[model samples]
Target: MSLTDSEILLLEQLIHDREVDKLFSRLTTITEETNPNYKLLFEAINSQKWGFNDKNRPVV
Candidate 1:
């Protein structure tokens, strides 16, 4: 799928903010195999809301 300027900007920002690294781990050559941690990270990023309170603040 093609991405718009805003999407690209957000992606760039995500990287700049170090959110991307926290989202996905090492790149995989084979789609069938990947680190389970990466999957968990992906789910966390896409989840509706972060499982934490503002005052407590959870580590990403």
Candidate 2:
């Protein structure tokens, strides 16, 4: 079965949101930690800009 354009778009959005949510959760956990090793990882994830690309696809 083929998905309609809207359905495909919705699915893509859901996936993107889930990934961002996971990243945010990880970031939160890292923030709560005292280990300095996580600092760089937290910074990297925090500095990442998430948005849709020109093709309307999610970019992380």
Candidate 3:
């Protein structure tokens, strides 16, 4: 599925929001960043729910 320009901007806005900082930080951390959970991370990130065009709310 392809995303339009607006959708890309929307997700970038959501990801940059302060509320999502913790998860972003964790993903950048040493241990977590090197974990084998890369598959899950890749899946979630590639999914429409967390990618550039995702419209769903993130599970808190």
* Segments in model 1 whose C-alpha atoms lie over 4 Å from true places: 19-60
| Candidate 1 TM-score versus the reference | 0.30
lDDT of model 2, residue 55 = 100
Candidate that would win on lDDT? 2
| Top candidate (TM-score) | 2
Please list the C-alpha lDDT of all candidates, in the order they appear: 0.66, 0.85, 0.69
TM-score each candidate. Answer: 0.30, 0.51, 0.31
Candidate 3, residues 1-60, lDDT tens digits: the string is 999999999988987896678878666564644767775685566665432436665653
Give me the displacement of residue 35 in model 2, in angstroms. 4.7
Candidate 2: regions farther than 4 A off = 31-60
Colliding residue pairs in candidate 3: none
| For model 2, the run of ten residues with the poorest summed lDDT | 26-35
- RMSD values for the candidates in order, in angstroms, are 10.8, 10.8, 15.1
- After superposition, candidate 3 runs with Cα above 4 Å error: 18-60
Q: Write the per-residue lDDT of candidate 1 for residues 1-60, one digit (tens) a residue.
A: 999999999999977778656445444232447667776766666775656677888645
